[model samples]
Target: MTYKYQLIFLGDINNNACNTIKVRFFDKIHSIGLRDNMFEIIYNETFERKYSNKQPSFVFYFGNLNHSEKDIDILKVLLDNGDAILPIYFGDNFEAEVPKIIHVMNGRQYIADHIEKYINYAFESMRLLRENRKLFISYRRTDSSAVANQLFDAFVRNNYDVFLDTYSINPAKNFQEELHHRMTDCDVLIQLYTNDFKNSKWCNEEIISANQKQIGVVEIIWPDCTPDIHNLLCEPIQLTQKMFMNEDFHNGSCCITEECIENIVNAVESVRARNLAARQDNLVGEFVEEARKQGRQLIQEYRYLVETLKDDIIRLFIPAIGIPQSYDCFDSLRFRKLLDNEKIELFLIYDDLRIRKKWVEHLEWLNESLEVKTIKKKDFELWLKNN
Candidate 1:
């Protein structure tokens, strides 16, 4: 079976910090409600067996290795295979602890309190979270307007490109259409789940649309309201009176405390990785399903997934969550360079749902001379039928 994500730990197996990191890693995963299929954590003991079956997607080397030559060979193989390895040290001396092979790459000095950052970067390295972060604030106006405004400010302060309907939508634009369009480009939906959230037609559809697009959701639920059942994989953060700055929740206002906002942001970061993987899976599955309808044999490989054809040609489809950027093309070019200079066609598979027409035209213009083209979700079936 093709796993969506894989993380492996190597080096200092007996370190207390490693144990601490492992415990918290699983806790973080559970806390965020990451789907079981989203990732698997392979330990040192089972490394060989697991590595034999499936290669590691990301590796955290705990540092200062006195490991056997055989294990070193395995690490070398991982490097040769282009797997991402992060050397983590605790003794302040990276060269003293990490082997010379990893010397060329930058190593991180492990901090006791920075496990969250480590895990977050691991996801980024795996292409689960794009470097540019953007989110949509989904809430019922009458129920969470105040809280929504507070979060918008907080997210903006944190350098996020957050989308709030009231502030984002222009004066003359088609409200519903523009709302839907902006949502297509957001990485996650921060839902302020109040008592009357479901009562609002637009609010209801925002959450539903987020799920349909396979975007992550961080639901901050009110004390009296039960968490919405739409996102089965998200463990909602239940709110209490203590979390409110005003110490009172009203029909149209909830000013959550600073601490609560921080927790919510962390929760969103955690969910972001898994949701990106899920979206890629959705896009790849849809494309492959379309291809199979016409009896085209496709195999899954590469960053998102790749397939080889009968004409000695390789097609690499990298899922472009939100918007496909210049970096996506550059990264794909880097990956392409790692392989033989074989006949290859690179593509960025994405959803065109509500994406701005101007950006779409820009992408089309970029495709004329650019070697890496794009395939939109809306055109998947037709793309297959014609291609």
Candidate 2:
């Protein structure tokens, strides 16, 4: 996807030079289907004001020997800070040689192609930098402003680029749009819940938005109240008003306090840690399931191979015996133990050779035993006849 980027062009190009650069950029942007709004161009004259206004994704400087030393120094500062600098020298001069500067030929296509590549690189770098430092805090003003202010101050003190509606964005503007943009750009959202918090549509909407965005939400509870908060949050941090007023809030310590402010900070940190752990666990579980499936498939294939070998062994060996006679080896005591273990008092069977031989002894034993008072065995046909 093509992302919007602010491009600031520096250097002292004359009227002809300016026209040439503008036409070149316009043609390139049009060719690539990019609108004028996608990029911004600034000269050295309006550099400071524009730079202070908005953060740019990429910077291009086109300078030559005719430029003043002060302008060269300013460009050097930008270059030293790792801003992408593209210089278009009027004539061949080795004096302004710098490893950071990319020499561009005075052609539309060449400038367009090089600028596009540089812009992409700059964008990717910005993305990585932004992903590393992102934090968002969500709180209801009706619940506790003091706690919210303290939390915002703590984050600011810690050098975190915190996005809390209380202080981050301009309150005078369209708040809903601003809030949506801030929440979407944030990596984590800290939610402070009070007794009356669930009743507010704005708070509920913020929570839902954070959840939908897959941003981490840490729910902090107000002191001395349990107002159906569980329905809104799976894991909420319980705290009280006294806990928030303590010195722990100032030091950025998450000591599991009952105060709302301390609890909020602690809960936010805990949720962040938990989210990281869950992501790792999910990755590990996926790998384990894949390995298990592979193992099961291997086992199935091995079993098939073994059965095939067994059939081959049987076919090669069984034919030599012509017709095999089946033999029965009975263990009376083991069979009796099995029956006793199963809690079965009697077993019925046909009048076989072994049954006939042991019939008198078995009857005598049963007559003397309390557990088994009788024993009977009959053929399937004979049992039907008797019934």
Candidate 3:
């Protein structure tokens, strides 16, 4: 009953994307070990009845330009209260259609299968998802460079922080060391499994490293190529000759059809969420084990860890997979109110490896003003021992 969140659907409820989002969103919640009751879905409910309070929400505003004055007013209130609202519109004249208050810099266009992109944005807004949408593309230049470049453009358009060695690595950095470091921070490894993918030294090493880290793999199997039977973490999408727009795929003109590109991108998004959840699970397990050793009793409450103490005091720990942001602090403080305990403490636990020096300094500065503190991954053992 603590820290329950809401997903509110506003404006153009009839949008096909709305219904599609609900089904997929539920799946995403389940993948992350959260129950349906932890997240309430609000649709067709009056703002006064359900959302009049200041609880944070993720709102999906659709393409319908025309909206009632009442709903518009409600949206304004939500914005003032710092609720997360996402507008989905494909048409021009976005400014003219929606009111200035509801207008965003840009809204995503609706694609049923590609709703993962929007969901990703929505979760980040709610601080349940990581701020960095990092992905690593593993493919051979000679075998699948063309298709890889096309997918890179497509993912970049969707706002993913993609790491392709040719584009992501800096000339000043060490090649092998940087490559391994880049792979460490990624949520998913999208490998273009060409005939020679396993044959390359770097490509094979990349796969080995990814599996050792237990990262999720989205395998795009090449045409006429057979995938390895091992690796339960690997989600394979076989490419037929028809999926390629270019007639000669063997000669390295691997331009995939638009539909094919969309499918692979969607697959990556789906796998990305699952991979993140798995990583979070590992973090939670490690923390729980350490807490037990320190004679601290920790219980699972929804997606967070809760430690109950005497005199109705409670400590809530939320797992932050990638970089922790300001929204994480704000959202955790908001949820602290929902618990019955008057004396409550909140913390965001995140991995500290490879985080930039400036970002860590910013987090240090940020913690001074906020009641919610962050615990770095490296300090888990010492924190457990002392606290």
Best by TM-score: 1
C-alpha RMSD by candidate, in order: 9.1, 31.9, 13.3
**Top-down TM-score ranking:** 1, 3, 2
Reference-based lDDT, residue 70, model 2:
30
Q: Per-residue lDDT tens digits of candidate 3, residues 71-135? A: 67767666544445676764665665555665532456666667897776667644454236778
Per-residue CA lDDT of model 1 for 233-350, tens digit only, reads 4448899988887678876765888899877766665676557556655666688778878887554433445566767777777777777776677667755665554587888888
- Candidate 1: misplaced stretches above 4 Å? 1-6, 9-41, 44-125, 128-130, 140-143, 153-160, 166-173, 224-235, 251-254, 288-304, 307-314, 325-343, 354-366, 378-387
Over 4 Å off, model 2: 1-131, 227-234, 246-266, 274-387
Given candidate 3, what's the lDDT at residue 269?
62
Structure candidate 1, residue pairs in collision: 64-97
